[model samples]
Target: MELYRKTLTSATWWSLVIFNLLTFSSCKNQPESTVPSWKIKLIANSTSHVTYLVDLERAIDHILRVQLVQVPVFKGKELIVLQNIMALLDNFNPLYKYKKGKANIKNINRFIKSQTEVSQEYFKGLANDDEFATENYIGDDYIGCLGSQSGLRGFNCSLWNLFHYWTVQSSFSPELFQPGAVLWTLHGYVHHFMNCSECYLNFWFYVQEHQIEDVKTHDEEILWLWRAHNYFNRKLAGDVTEDPWFPKKQFPEDKYCRKCRWKGKWQNDKVLKYLKNIYSSISEVVGLINKEEEP
Candidate 1:
């Protein structure tokens, strides 16, 4: 009887040990999630801001394409390009007009609405007038002249010229002129703009949390992004100019020489300094965060 009882006690102890081992092994073998939980939390807490950032990034890409490449060419036949440019500008107008209260987007929103109405009317007029299209297509110069005569101003002219030039010079398929790319690029700009706006909004929230009344203005935030964008632009230009393939091509003495020299020297140096300033600001913010983390 004593031996049987001892045997039973040993079996029970061994069984308990096996159960614990199995449990631990199961835990150890379980697959860990790949996604960062902290990022998820941050996103969840600031969903609107995140969306805004993404849109602003998209917008920035569109803006860069328009300013650096498209606008410079400005030939005449590309109606789609012009439409896309106008659409993007319209989309971003709201950000510029943000106010403190009562929906805060009065000025820009009004401007966009008016522009949209005008664009719709213009398209309707175009559809009705076959003669207008025939007269406009004689040549690049004629098309540009007609567009200007049509009283389309500002970014509209810039957009019209870019695609027109591309169409005149390149053998690209007509389908390539579809406005979808413009929409997608504009989305990037909107993403970046929203990101910037959220950064400011977050700063404002932080200020409020600390009971601080003073806050940076929206203009200041826009200027900050503009400066950053310009810095990046110069960096990209410098990279291109420094390439062995670039400077070898003979440039026009009257136009390209001075511009290339400036790009290589003063502009590149200034951009580097601007980028350094941005880095310094970021480092200071990081240091503050680290200090706060210290218990």
Candidate 2:
């Protein structure tokens, strides 16, 4: 009887140890929690109107100075797409107040149009051209697109901001271009020039999956881009590349625009109004530019 009792006690002890080991192993193998440590909210100054424009200008400079020259191939449809992008920027870009900067945009467009095939060196020379002198006129630093980490969100974020800005500005000036021209141009740019293979594929698939060609009306185009941007935000949330300080969530969170949502549904008219106010409204633009230019 004594021997049996001792055996039973030992069995119980071993079982308990094994159960705990299994439980711990199971917990260890489980996926890491998606909940971030930092409280997520829109960082207020990150999205200021003038900062958006300034960042857009910086992004444009990056494109002219760096991104364009890196294009691996400059033939066939690629050349036409590049020319079209430059022409679109020359014609529709609203932020170019300085004469030399506007001249640079025009000169680049003309250069691409004149070239049957452009080497990377040719592009480099065009970017470095003394006649254009882009650095003298446009922003050379990023204000709104600065990420917490060294390379988290500078160029990619700036491009999206510029895309949204162009879409809104297009809505405000429909006669200057087609309703979907800005997005179409964006698609071509991403399809050809966006260096990240994964990012380019994601954008290409999204454009195809969502019927980007069918976006017809100006209002629809504005909202389409808004929705598209939010789609990317949702996709990239919690990604390793995400900036913790600027956590990706739906844009125009209630903190930014109270009327943008009600009962968890997007009030798109109010959202449109908000976008226009930030991107295209003259009074707001004047105020922001004044504040931005302040010494």
- Index of the highest-lDDT prediction: 2
Residue pairs of candidate 2 with colliding backbone atoms: none
As a TM-score, model 1 comes out at 0.20
Against the hidden true structure, what lDDT does model 1 obtain? 0.27
lDDT of candidate 1 over 1-295, digit per residue (tens)? 0100011122222223212211211212223334343433342233121112113322222343333232222222123233344443343331232222112223223443344233434333432344422322211221111111122111322232232222221112223333223322222322221122112231233223321112133222222323322332343343321222112122122242243235444343343333333222211011011233459
Q: Each model's TM-score, in the order given? A: 0.20, 0.73
lDDT of each: 0.27, 0.62
Please give the range of 10 consecutive residues that has the lowest summed lDDT in model 2: 1-10
Model 2: how far residue 245 lies from native, Å: 0.9
* Model 2: per-residue Cα lDDT at residue 223: 88
| 131-197: candidate 2 lDDT, tens digit per residue | 6544434445555565554555667777777777778877777777776777666655654565322
- lDDT score, residue 41, model 1? 39
Per-residue error (Å), model 2, residue 265: 0.6
